[model samples]
Target: MTKTLGRRLFGFGSSGRSAARNPGGATTAADCLRLYDDAAAAGPVDAELAEAAAAVRQLPAADPGMTDALLALGGAALARDLPPLALAAADAVLTRRKGSRAAWHLRGRALEVAGDLAGAVEAFEGYLERTDAASAGAAEVTARIAVLREAHSWRQDVVGALDGTAPGVGALAAGPLPAFEAALGRHLDDRLAAAGPEEAAGLARVVGLHAERRRHQLLPPLADPLQGGTGRLRIGEFRNLVAGRSVCLVANSQTVGGGALGADIDAYDLVVRFTSFRIDPAATGERTDIHVTGHRGALNWDRRVTTRLVFSDRPEDWRQALRTRLVPGAQRFTGDDSLRRPLRTVGGLTPERWPAPLTCGFEMVWLLDFLDVSPRLDLIGFDFFATGHHRLAEAARIAGPSDYSSEKAWVMERAQHVTGPVIALR
Candidate 1:
């Protein structure tokens, strides 16, 4: 990346300085080193950073500290919004040490900032190859790769659509629902072809439901689901409702119905449940503070529920639910379709190649954590889709498109960690 190109893309001027000087009016290697450290920590364009960069350039060709200095300067440059300088520093380190993992990681970040998505992927992959896959660093890089790849694909689609080179790109404009339905159709077809008669019959029902959803788009898209759209409560408003208060999230797993935790669940400050949840007073809670559901299936809205939150990647699906499934006298809320990919980045919980849509239950977990809702958040009846025993018959019969294994692992890991809210698995 050239300085001129960086300036044009990032709208920042280049740092200009001649050399580093001490109070005694003389420059030394120690002073230069200190300046580099200060610049890296400060993370801004200033006389100190410019002087450090100039002094580093004057170092001896084979200086032993050259690589380290360059790495530090690269980080400083990246923090200061100088992608060109960061890129140059990363390149210098790689040239000196071909297998330098830090250099490749730095290059990847700089490329990402410079809007070179492809190059960023290449550099990050290089870093991943050199790092241990079992390490936390590897997990973070894997998540980063997933995000970058999605961004790259979305950017390509946009460009192709603008140039009249991509025909189905318009499907994206409608939201992820169209693409999800197409993928689900293919998945069902492949499974049906290989399944026994009984399994095939169940798969056919799923296909029928999918088709019904498409045929029932009787209304136009709903208003945006973000804060300023429709009757949705602001994120801050929801946060205030739950912050510092005990919260319980009840799932539809059959295992829950076997237990007698209803009173415990209802005792919390708030009780939340997913779509089609059962109401066995002794097993499941009777109170419904919030009801969360997707666009598909029948919405059995409880009369006592105070709020209804709808989640769908497709605006049309949300609109359909609002028109056909919404219950009166309840506060309504929904998430923006655009938040799907970005929300996946929350807690780095998603797998490296998750093409399927997230389940409404999993999204609620992520949202609660993102909002820092409460100190103690209880998870009831969640077996991560294991045993496939849902309260609703159709839900138990058909497997949805979500990656259950990944969601389970993410929740398990979060439960084991100490940083976030205490996610008590019941």
Candidate 2:
């Protein structure tokens, strides 16, 4: 594992830097240690990281203080995806550096990569506490501690709130539509009262789906219940940040009625990033710029989702196209095409789409505002996540990746809801 660890560092897809660098005229123990420290800060999977990892491995063989370097190298190896090697390297470091924080950090990272988040968190916390207060990367280590804490908090909140429950919008079984409606209405009203009219309308539409699902359980309705998509969708806006000339608002909602029965929830998860905003510096008019996609809900299920919108002095033509054209085109798929293609198209002015690896600092304001006028849908609720572009970008990176699995892919497909790791267990 130790031998292969060096080679594994060579094929990383991202940066190509080493974890450590050799400064001029420095071969002393202090200089070597400092270089290894620099390498860790530079990051693992770097050009010098391999050398640093090797140096650390060898350092402990000669000097005891170099045990810290050995431990750090193990963490670097794991970050570089050389797990077996990382395990061996970390073990080597821990053998001599028994109680050193760097060794523990490496072990923690290795465990984390091995899918032991809890264990990893414990080790990282211990390492942070043991490390010197004035370490070069102390701030970063502190930030990591915060991140782990937040992730833990968020995970707990989600589990406590929704764990062991169904994972779908349909979790509100049809047997209790009246109760569901009452409860849902109260929830919506309480949370969304302060939102704009458009947001309120959009949110109401999402709630309306609950009512519709109660009447027909895979059975046809006696007649088309009111013209479909005719009502205004509700949007429940929550947080709003005042940008220089524009305002960045974060809104979320329980969007029901977007999918038909037996729709997939594991399909590609949709992330709406707000790119830029168009606001009048002179006048206080409201306008924003953004892109939206992932229309094909979950696993290519036919669902109308508005990804992004660009507002203007006149009106957002592209947004209307999404509501009128692209969404309908996606609805036409008869299970033959890939479920994701509907929301993954390009080269059309209608819903002007872009490829994946989406831009950050963008949001779905147009749809959020549009939800206000469209009443047939429900806009559950929105959360104010960040204040500005920097925060927004940070939020985007933290939102994690999407899950796009088909309904047919899991045995629990018929259940009202699904939770915890959306993907099917191996």
Candidate 3:
């Protein structure tokens, strides 16, 4: 198998969403050995990193330098117990070098050791996907996937929670009603009170999905049931920032076509993007003021971006980031507020729309209320990710058929809420 494919399944580099691997760098086996030794010996990490960095400069597509350097860096970091750095190095290598036979093994090892069994499974599966399935390590990777499946089976936990909750508002436009809120609240409260060590992982996943579903309709009772997106920023504080200003939020959409770098798109006073947000500078303009995301919940786009980033579904991944950390305008939003409104407001909407009623509808309302409520907002390249068959199938399973499409329709209907202007860059 080629090294490049191997790397894509597991490579890591730079930081944030825009970071990509340099395709030009090539490394030799000799460089790999020397760098690995120094990186492993390491009086300081920077010294070893510098050695690997220097080597990458000389690498070309034909040479083995890039792969070797990344391996060396990953190995050394693993030796030092820096799993994140190790994972990053592996990921960086895999991005531009997709054919590496060893990249798969490296990524799987890093993810597994880091407690991200789901990601490890995906990495191993990806390795198996590109390489000869009957190859020497294929059996072991298949075994790993089996183990990971046990964890993914936890998806049923959320389904059960949804089934248990009494249905409410059919239309998100009406917001969460009384009967709906009561049923959902009881369920979330039970989860919150019952979440223990053994069930921490399952509960966390349930909470994450549940809260997100609530957010699709409108901000849940600010309880942030899952504790995933909760940060220091408060609701009013978020709203005040953009209450009367011009703001722009960009989404990673295939429909951007050739307008990503268009001058009008770049002219927005502020720009917001999501996790592992990627764009070609020449194709997409170079302007990003804020990044709104909470790591790759189901995709290994970027390793444990938040301290809340959970690697292991076996353990809770919803811990809070340290107060002292510097993520630059990045924050979380685990719902945290008390709701006291007419129960009918929530109860009035029937479950006819959604038996469970939480679709990942346009989260802009939640954003407008809690994040940046810029009166004038432009949502660019914001297609509902409805292009591919795979996405369609996934959406069917996750959001139900009608809910996803309805969400798009709802967002389009609410365009007037955005300071009387709704620009569709598609």
Expressed as tens digits, the lDDT of each residue in 249-357 for candidate 1 is 8888766777778888889988988887778989886888887787775756534466667676555565566666655545444332323223453344455555457
Candidate 1 backbone clash number: 0
For model 3, residues 1-426, the per-residue Cα lDDT tens digits are 122223232343232112112221443344344533444354344565556555555556456445565666666555555545566666666665666545665666666555455566667776787654533246557877896565444334444555543233221111112323345556667766867777666566557765765566584454333333444322222333344456665655554433434455567665555434555565445565544433123322222222121211111122232222223323342211211011111223344643433322234333442333365677765566544222212223332334466556656765654322235321
Q: Please give the distance, in angstroms, between residue 40's alpha carbon in candidate 2 and its true position after superposition.
A: 24
lDDT of each: 0.60, 0.35, 0.45
Worst 10 residues of 3 by lDDT: 335-344
TM-score per candidate: 0.41, 0.25, 0.31
Candidate achieving higher lDDT, 1 or 2:
1
Q: Supply every candidate's count of residue pairs whose N, Cα or C atoms clash at under 3 angstroms.
A: 0, 63, 51
Model 2: runs farther than 4 Å from truth?
1-76, 84-88, 134-136, 165-426
Better of 1 and 2 by TM-score: 1
Model 1 worst lDDT window (10 residues): 15-24
lDDT score at residue 114, model 1, on the 0-100 scale? 61
Provide the global lDDT of candidate 3 against the true structure.
Answer: 0.45
Write candidate 2's Cα lDDT for 120-189 as tens digits: 5666766667654543234446666676565445334433443433234123322112333355445555
